[model samples]
Target: MTLRRLHSLQQWLKEKDVAYAFIQGKANLFYLTGFRCEPHERLVSLLVFQDNEPCLIAPNMETSLICQSGWNYPIIGYSDSEDPWRLISTHLSSLEIVGSNLAVEKELLSVARAEQIKALSPELALLNCEDTIMKLRLIKNDKEIAILKEAAKLADFGVEVGVHALNTGRTEMEILAMIEYELKRKGIREMSFGTLVLSGEQSANPHGKPKMKSIEKGELVLFDLGVVLEGYCSDITRTVAFGNISTEQEKIYETVLTAQEATLSLCRKGTVLGDLDRKARSIITDAGYGAYFPHRIGHGLGVEVHELPSLNENNQDQLQVGMTFTIEPGIYVPKVGGVRIEDDVLITEDGYECLTHYPKELLVVKP
Candidate 1:
């Protein structure tokens, strides 16, 4: 499977007339080579040349660890104390022509790093390869799809556990802690992003953090979370009312829920992407709460929490099979609290398949 990916990458390299392309971003590194690194100060890059056979470069200490990581590629290591760019330049000078075109990921490469690489090979043509990589990652193959499904399932399970733990007296932090623990218990190696758990008035702030304040009566409880499973990620959000929900709160919840459902209903092969977003917005507007729905209807979800083919006003891309993204419609009224319903969905050949199964009904958790 990895080799197939490598071949595809090499083909892209050849088509672009790229003599040497440096890949340094974690997502790019993981996509090209399955070497997931623990957070540390280290340089991980793949220098692929016109010949298709590329060299994996990293600090000396991690060389063997990476080489044995099932990547099945020749890796070259350099000591941290030594100038790795010198080694890179030497290889470039010996292997490829001095004036050969080289592409660097502008979005991923730090300006300082790009300058450093330029200093290594002053004669090489450097251009941003962001478009190339973006195109490559736009579509997911079978392997990625399976991993994504696992991620979605585990995240849904975590939310379920978190929901059961919510009550009037439970601190927002306590609920978040339980969600984190549940993710670990479910065999999730790590949380994709820190869980977003908001209770009551805190929910009024769109991106508020979990707090020590206790969840109060008659307020919305929002659980927004995802987990990393098999190198992929999942994202989901479920809002349930605790105690008696007021008329305004119920209307907000019902409106957002309707918009979310309408957005998903438009997800099928050949569907106009932007139309779904408009549908969500239309629902909110018709409900007399359009101005409150500030964010886009949805965004693609995969390796990263936010990917591509964003469901917004301007996007014109057609929904395609194998594409997975989020449909989260929200209505946030400051001081009045908020309501949002989100789900991970997969676009199939015929229609769409909903990956998230967490209950969406307004469950009034008693104080």
Candidate 2:
């Protein structure tokens, strides 16, 4: 139940002289506590003290699920009519957490909630522990890597569903619906991100929204999607030819494929993170599509699709074994179509393993 992670946090608190740590991010909360829930407007958190048992503050309705998830710690559930922050203050006082140093997730905690915590302990020194938590979560454990591998298979399955659903004159939304429906039938509760199905010229927009526009013949169809399976996530993007295609279209697709492959080949232990982005960017730039390929190479993937160690040209982090991320390179033209090939990868001791095994070769579907 991630009790080891809890101990690690407590050790960090003791070293830093922090009294307590307030974990508010849903992803971080699930990572440390083994409990997953989205309270929305309601308050859901895990309070960890330096020298005491951790406490879980959650909605009364979620108590059973929290226990079922293997969390056997002290839980203080509050009804919607009750004040959660006030209860937290009382708990803090009882544990001698009042008027002491406190650490919190600066990125995840909202302004109003921070204000409420301050009201409870105005003299309390508030510190940001986001980086410390991120450092703990950066390198995936063996179990997390295994779950990510399964998730990668589901992500590849998602691409297969989307590709099979592709047809001439089919609207982008229709294909999106077909893909999502197929995933739901397979028991995938959610996608890592919104399903992206862009066809023809619409695909050139890179981040374009799926519309009712029909996918015409000889157009490029980009499928950027992933599925959340067993709490981990997998993201993949594959651009394919619809019916007949032109030489220019095929060249763009090939260039992007080359960039992805070259960047992936460099995903091993001790590799500087920025070099990966540079390798892909250099290939795209040498292909005369530098301006078209605008976005960073990729991002770290795990409980959240985007996480630590963003693969950008300026990042200085080094890739280590057990760290997982994506390597995606694309070329998007205005009037023309776009081509993006992405794969989830795991940095290994010697080389690397491609988690998402979906075919990146140009596939021309029958219309």
- Give the top-scoring candidate (TM-score): 2
lDDT of 1 by residue, 131-235 (tens): 666656767887888888888888788788877898768898998998888778767777778788898878877778898988888889888899877667799
Superposed on all Cα atoms, the candidates' RMSDs to the truth, in angstroms, are 1.8, 1.2
Model 2 pairs in collision:
none
Each candidate's number of clashing pairs is 0, 0
Q: TM-score for model 2? A: 0.98
Candidate 1 pairs with clashing backbones = none
Deviating ranges (above 4 Å) for candidate 2: 98-100
Error of 2 at 246 (Å): 2.1
